[model samples]
Target: MEKIIKEAIYIQSPTYIGSYKEEDCIFLLKDISHLVTEKDDKEREEDINDGVHYSQMLPFEDTPSDEYMNIFYESLKENAMKVAVNTLRICEQILKNKGNDVILVSLARGGTPVGVLAKRYIKYKYNIDCPHYSLSIIRDKGLDENALIYIINKHKSTNIQFIDAWTGKGVVNHTLEKACREFNMKYEVDIDSGLAVLSDVGRCAKIYGTREDFLIPSACLNSTGSGLISRTFLDDKIISKHDFHGAKYYSNWKDIDCSNYFVDYISELFEKIDTKSGDKYTDINIKTAREDLIDIQKRFGVDSIRKIKAGIGETTRVLLRKIPYKILVSDINNPNVKYVLLLAKDRGIPIEIYKDMNYLCCALVTFAE
Candidate 1:
């Protein structure tokens, strides 16, 4: 399947729906906000379980409440330095390994903010203005081929590095590797699938800032935190072969959108923290994390590993989007999961104290019948 590389349909902040600056990152996604209808969360979850590809539909996102917003701000204030330090570490590693001319292709939504922060850090520290683009990569549908082709045509494939905020069950990591292989075969270009993340709670990625399952405030909100952009959507009915994967821009949410605030707050701390010291990647027991996940699946009777979302970020996502069966927390008093507790309580979802769990918290998605 030979694909003719065409100029990628890309957009920057303000011009599109995102609040990011023009230089922060380019979004390689077509805005299909007007073309697709939103589905109720529960209905969407049930449809996904019935073998409907999740990327085909967008879930309706509600405006977060004042209380929830408070939690997000509190979490950010408490963990700003932690996130800043990790971002620096990841950026430094990128320069050391991939060199100065690396192109950052952050997986859309979650990775957008992290990519923007990394790009800012590289310029601030090394004075290198590396190009950054946010593209969509659905789990089953694979990387947006058109987006990949567009980027490959513009930048050196070898210099491309994928970035994401954190790893959940490492599903995306495996998905990314598989997609890259198929894409390379089709396009005859080698794009490395190595994902650089701020938090590697799943202990999956080769490059990560920390293995601690702490709260990344970005996970606290939906599209509002991610440039008011809906999760990347792809439907054959709406998306064409020549079109990039689709996403809806939450234009109405601009007033309350925290996308820019999240990045700006963390980026501001870059100069204050000493990136040289205490910036070592602590080795985590990947085997143990994997074993723990398997044990969790068995104990919870979850048939699919995808249903068991581990780590603070993953758990937050389950609470925000999926029909959660229950939430497990290692410690109830830990400030890292304050937002989790709030969400669970608000939803009236059962919360269990799993003292021996590997992650600080984990969310079990209900098997929608």
Candidate 2:
């Protein structure tokens, strides 16, 4: 029993593909950010029209010119502490709402760091050692059923909360909901798909920390920001029935791993916080985001509600992942919008400067005939 348990320690498992190196924790994200190709105009049009999965292909990786890197470094230096403190407060709120015994299973790649950070906060603030698991949730393909099985067997089906970095169209939430339903049917286990995110620009999730659409700092870079794990893939050739989704380990990219820097930046700010009863934030305002998303969606036009991707984080994702027709900017003059403009230009997507968008920016998806 001891040997088996030890063997399973850091095992990628049948549902995961990457081997554990050191605990960078940003594994799958690092790979996807680098490997995924940009969709050309023709290719982008075909994808949006056909409703294909975008993860299968990667765009050319943008090597931030010296200017962008300088800006990114400056942003990280300035904002990492604030983000960490805010995240700690959010984690405390979540723990209070759910009770301290809840299990945190982060959607692999993006949510892992958030989960780890949240776990750290719980330990520092409340002395709770919650277990954090990073699992896969493919956009349309859904969460890995095998991962669900592993959790059920190991943890005996405790209260599970799904975590992510941010939501765009709430694809991860919807994907997990459907995946959990199928999992219950197959394994006779139930895991609530209700999610928690650092930000909710899509207005899809029930529990979240913030609605701010500003650059997450993490979104500005790929595996360098995440641990050096590749994106998860379900291709039959690479993944077998018993195998976890596959990801490549970029051992070569160790020099660029910002996982520690990101974590340390946020964590070091813990001393500055009061952690007192009245000063700490509670998620009383989560409802506002839901209403805000709906209002913005309708204002944009009920028909294009799906196209109106709000929040700076989501807009950045649209620029990265989807065929963006045009960018709706909240503050056209904001220097923060420059990166969005840079990537949009790379893909030939247009940016329309707007006076106001309830969120930071909205990306309209264009389908090509």
Candidate 3:
């Protein structure tokens, strides 16, 4: 497929739903709120497992309660320093490997906040105003080539570094790798597919801040935490060849959107923590993690590995977006998953304690009926 050379529209903060400043990052996504048909979580999950692509529909995102918001704040307070340290480490590594002029292309939704923090770190530490943009990359549909072409034309392809908040089962990494290879072959340019993240619990990415599957508070909420933007959506009926992948801006959620608050809270701690002092390279047992995933599949009779979501971040996502069958936690008392516990309890989902698990927690999706 030849690369489409259409210029997709890019939106900045305030003009769009995100709370970040215009200079922080530009979103390469169309507002498709009017086109999206929001479905109940159970209905959406069933449709997805029945072979319907999730990108065809949106899950109804409820407004989090004050109590839930309190937990998010608590988690932020507890893990702010850790997040700040890792953000700096990831940014430093990017500069060292990709150079000062590198463009930070964060995978939409989850990666947006991390990209903003990274951009802030680079500016504060190196005084480099590197361009940052958030674009969509669906699981099976591949990346929005139009968005990639737009960015490549505006910036050097060699300097692009993909960013995300964390790795789940490394599915996105695989999707990104395959897409980048195809894009490079067709366009005759190399865009590195190695994803940079704050947490690499899946032990899949080559560049990461830590291998610990701790709570990243941003994962606690949906659009409210991610600049009030829906997860990237793509449907042939709604999205055109030239348009960027679609996303719905949660305009009504603006009053409670903590997107800016979460980033700024962590960014403030950047100066206090010494990113240079921590051990950037830690021993990560990818084999054990992979083995555990297989074991979970066998034990739970999960038909597809995609139904088994591992790690704190992934587990939270399953509870939030999918119809969770059950939640497996290494330690129920662990503060890292306080929000996860609350979510599971709220949904009346079954909880199991897996003491010998590789990741802190995991969530199993209900089989389609």
Candidate 4:
């Protein structure tokens, strides 16, 4: 079926909690195949480098076992209160600088929930509803043009602030900037490529909530934490030029879905927590992260920074989505890194304690080179 807001149409899924404001934006996307016959991590990597997009090659791993899921739940309980408060603080700074008329366009899948949380908190604190929309961005393929066109038509591109859940080695952030430049040059339209994320451990973005690199409980699970929506996809056959790319709405997984629950739960904590001024974490210049990434690449004899995903959130992503070669930890016992340690062990991967980095840990993705 279709959702009509003003004059725009968005085909939505029953699995998604409706978050669109009736006056501002259209969440346009197509419901496509959910199954990829799950591939082993190695296969996903090989396919990714061989001129095929990773999202088109595999389905995600099944939900983590109860033990791993327990780690995430515990993290949520321990960190959510303070984290929510800090999030509001950073968001406040962003709104202060950008003004209240900004729109949040989150990078799909990983970014979707972070955008939702920001929108919820903004409304709760300021009594002003911010429109949040999640759209697809593939690393090599660039941003989804059709979706961008749709968003631009519905809202002013100048007011759009792209959102991401976190910054790892800042690949997606750079990719976004490059993609926006390309979009502007190809179509002769301006859309801000500057991204705002809940965490910026990679030190890549200007507007960020925190740069702490801790486990964001939600980073511990797949699909379940994201409105039961599959990672965004773009294949020529599966997505036409004019369609808003595609994603599978996991309606069958609602009973296990914590997508909306995660956002709502965090939003509630905002009420109980004080929004006082604090420097729990602040921005780090991108130069440091860049120089270090290059050093790590040379030291490890690695082929590319693309394979060296740093920070706890990104390390978790390596375990979750990619084939992890090895994990280097500043502290194996860091409470924030419990999920990473568990994921490494569960996958039978090696973990090395090397304490010279800025982040809690770093994950060396399987280097296909």
Candidate topping TM-score: 1
Worst 10-residue lDDT window for candidate 2 reads 1-10
Q: Model 3, 158-251: lDDT tens per residue? A: 5689999998777788899999999888777778899999998777786888888888989878899888888889888898776788899888
Native-vs-model 2 lDDT?
0.62
lDDT of 2 by residue, 97-146 (tens): 67877778787776766776777777777788876777777877887665
Between prediction 1 and prediction 3, the one with superior TM-score is: 1
Candidate 4: stretches off by over 4 Å:
1-27, 34-38, 42-46, 278-287, 320-323, 342-348, 367-369
- TM-score list, all predictions: 0.91, 0.75, 0.90, 0.85
Q: What TM-score does model 1 achieve against the real structure?
A: 0.91
Better of 1 and 2 by TM-score: 1
Per-residue alpha-carbon lDDT of candidate 1 for residues 26-62, written as tens digits (9 for 90 to 100) = 8888888789989986788688778888888998888
**C-alpha RMSD of candidate 3:** 3.6
- How high is the CA lDDT of each candidate model? 0.82, 0.62, 0.82, 0.71
Q: What is the lDDT, from 0 to 100, of the residue 47 in candidate 2?
A: 72
Question: Which residue pairs overlap in candidate 1's backbone?
Answer: none
Quote the positional error of residue 338 for candidate 1 in Å. 3.2
Q: Model 4 residue 172 lDDT?
A: 90
